[model samples]
Target: MAVAQKLQRCAVSQTGKHSASVIFLHGSGDTGQGLRAWVRDVLKQDLAFAHIRVIYPTAPPRPYTPMRGALSHVWFDRYKISADCSEHLESIDSMCTQLGTVMQEEVRAGVPKNRMIVGGFSMGGAMALHLACRYHPEVAGVFALSSFLNKDSVVYQAVQDRKGQPLPELFQCHGMADELVFHQWGEETGVQLRHAGMDASFRSIPGLNHQLSRMELEELRSWILKKLPLESSAQGQ
Candidate 1:
């Protein structure tokens, strides 16, 4: 495998002093710019996000195991796409390290781990779950759209290894009609997370598909605001 490209990041600068941050990873084969556009066109419609800095990170081009080793922009390589498939830990560990470094940089730049939320779509969401739960539990929150985890995900092991440490809250949303990643798998992921003692919440969207829906984004907005609210100083009071 050729050396993967360096991770790239595109950001939506906050209108006010950046009090909180949201690091959203794009799905496989997608770039940071694409997710950045989606955030600006859709999520930015809500004025409450004016003070929030949204960072969209792009994965480096690497050989994806599922696609006959074809190069794709993915956080990690996977042999299969099902929740029960075996995880590719070698690549997963590397990606987790990169993501961890990103969050640490955010902390040094002013946003504490407690004021940052990490999330993503599809494969990206899986990475978000790994980053928040396995790598950095101090994050404020996590959200995954149409995502899942393997039956023996290291996330479960990491949580169990912690032995009662507080974890970041997680919000998950899945479309009822999702075909690419089954809705049932998303539910199971939630169940497994909860069983592992994670503070996880799962939402089901009816008549939807593998893609995102406006309703889901609205719910995410509400969840984010609740998790990372502005303090008096950051609110420009």
Candidate 2:
């Protein structure tokens, strides 16, 4: 069996009025509850966040791809650290199974697939991107920050399993100064995603590193609200 932790969400419906859900799969080493804190401070402050629930899945230890000098948790192990070749096949398989379990748990809690959005930071973002690109029937959406795609040798097999499905809209952001995952990975990931027929909106924030900014959070909040069945009138003050 796999280890899993539930995201202690901030916005719980008192009478169960949760209209939508955003699942946050955090990067390795970060607590699963970090996403909830992020929402309370940043996303929740936005007008749009009032109508939805955000799910943050906490990953349990053991059996991630090799990362030298870093003992953090990871969705998969992409050791290439460069564009040469980092296969994501193994990571993809593991993540799909774990994520499916998490999604099922949410559905049981009254969250539906169409209304759920998944996202992560750094390595967690990589996992989020992978799920959206490969999972059939798509999902509500995906948001990836400071992450890249895992190159798999058997990618064709994965795609074949998908049967040429259209992917969901992806919102990705990266800091040009990220010391760990190079910023170029973000651009390349966007290019690859678009080539694979995904609607990817990529952004690069100069002088920022790793952490999400107030500005970026606003943009993400806006974009998410637009995608969900939120009230459009909430836009523009």
Candidate 3:
């Protein structure tokens, strides 16, 4: 018997025939609907994304250790903020499985693995990075906004093992003034990825906070266009 599809709570948008897909995971304490609305507004002014399918998946609400065991939708359990940010391997692995399922569904629906982009904000972005590093079926790109990576040697080893697979182009945007994730952590994450032989681009936005800014979104749009160029016929249509 085929396994039942346990689809994560998500909000989806597909304008025309879906030639490409972008999965955007929401941050902790945020809903898929909220991220979907934000993405919709961002795409409204840019018609180039009309043919791209965007999905915002909500993380399952669970007890967060960093928040004193308060329940929230987080990608993984909070880890110590040391030089090597330790994470719960089990939690990270579970979320990666969940995200992989979502990606597989898109592939079954006719989208190619290379044409799909995976990204997220804050905690969600961190998970995206983790997922991309450890999983198979390379994606087109990965966007990590105001996020960091699991500095554990195990995580690095997983990435090293995937050296044979084509690494996805990574676009990391972080606010220099971010208090939650810390700007330093973002910078170090980029460096670490590069040292591991991944093509990672880290953009530092000065004076911004832990949240996404308009400038960051604009940069994201540009990055998307570079990865998945809009068809000429679709231009100005």
Each prediction's Cα lDDT score?
0.85, 0.67, 0.77
The sequence of per-residue lDDT tens digits that candidate 3 reaches over residues 7-57 is 466545456566678888888788777776665575554323665777787
How close is each model in CA RMSD to the real structure? 2.2, 4.4, 3.2
- Best-performing candidate as measured by lDDT: 1
Q: List the residue pairs that clash in candidate 3.
A: none
Question: Higher lDDT: candidate 2 or 3?
Answer: 3
Model 2: how far is 141 from its true place, Å? 1.1
lDDT of 1 by residue, 53-99 (tens): 88888898989988999999998998887677789988888898888
Instruction: Rank all candidate structures by their lDDT, best first, as comma-separated numbers.
Output: 1, 3, 2
- Which scores better on lDDT, 1 or 3? 1
lDDT per residue as tens, model 2, 141-232: 88888877644434324444555665567898888888865788677877766665667789999998877777777778788878776544
Global lDDT of model 3: 0.77
Off by over 4 Å in 1: 1-6, 40-48
Q: After aligning candidate 1 to the native by TM-score, how far in Å is the CA of 141 from where it should be?
A: 0.7
The alpha-carbon lDDT assigned to residue 37 of candidate 2 equals 72
Query: How many pairs in model 2 have backbone atoms within 3 A of each other, for residues 3 or more apart or on separate chains, i.e. clashes?
Result: 5
